[model samples]
Target: AQSVAQPEDQVNVAEGNPLTVKCTYSVSGNPYLFWYVQYPNRGLQFLLKYITGDNLVKGSYGFEAEFNKSQTSFHLKKPSALVSDSALYFCAVRDIRSYIPTFGRGTSLIVHP
Candidate 1:
């Protein structure tokens, strides 16, 4: 079985400081990893994906993630946080042949001024 875990329920960061939201996964086969962001009362927006090749993948709004196969982890990162960046984030993963992806419970990112 494949699954993803987002240990933190929320992350608090200053507007100008860097931020990170942790993620870990378990899969039977090669996994397609993804990160999505959701604002209040809105659907999730695709932030990035890791299919193959590069370990470091960049995404929208200056967000990036590193795919570590050995550790079975893919953590989201940003050098500078913004007040507008405050939202909920979800980490997802799917097997190569699976159409339905499993998502983490979600992590609330609060960027303060």
Candidate 2:
């Protein structure tokens, strides 16, 4: 089974400050981790993924995440937060053998200007 956990239901940050959304996962084999952001009434947009290379991975909208093998974690990060960055963020984990990925409940990121 593959599972992802977003511990916090919501995260608040000021504009221009760095922000993080915590995520953890469990899988049987190699884990493929992904981060996505959902705008209200819109579909989830792919942010980043940890597939093969370095533990530290960067992605769209200046987002990044570090994959910790030992902890089975993949927490998303942003150098600076924007009010526009406020959205629902989701963490997903997939087992290579599985066709579909399992997503977390999602974290609501609120960036105040």
Candidate 3:
């Protein structure tokens, strides 16, 4: 079975500070990892993806993630956080057996002004 876990339900950070959202995954075979963001009542927007390349993958909105195969983790990171960066984030994984990816429950990132 393939699954994704976002340990945090919410992350509160002040503007101009670095932020990170934890994510861990389990899969049977090779996994395609992805990060997505969603605003209120809006569909998820792709942030980044790690297929097979460098361990560090950058994405939209100055977001980046580190893929650690041994730890089975892909944690999202940003050096500086902004008020507009506040949004709901979801981590997903697609296994070789299936095309559809399994998404995490979602972590709310509140970047206060």
Per model, how many backbone clashes are there? 0, 0, 0
lDDT of each: 0.97, 0.96, 0.96
Name the lDDT of candidate 1. 0.97
For candidate 3, the C-alpha RMSD (Å) to the true structure equals 0.7
Candidate 2: how many backbone clashes?
0
Which residue runs does candidate 3 get wrong by more than 4 Å?
Answer: none
Residue 60 lDDT, candidate 2, scale 0-100? 97
Rank candidates, TM-score, best first: 1, 2, 3
TM-score of each: 0.98, 0.98, 0.97
lDDT of 2: 0.96
Where does candidate 2 clash, by residue pair?
none
Let me know the TM-score candidate 1 reaches against the reference structure: 0.98
Query: Residue 109 deviation, candidate 3, in Å?
Result: 0.2
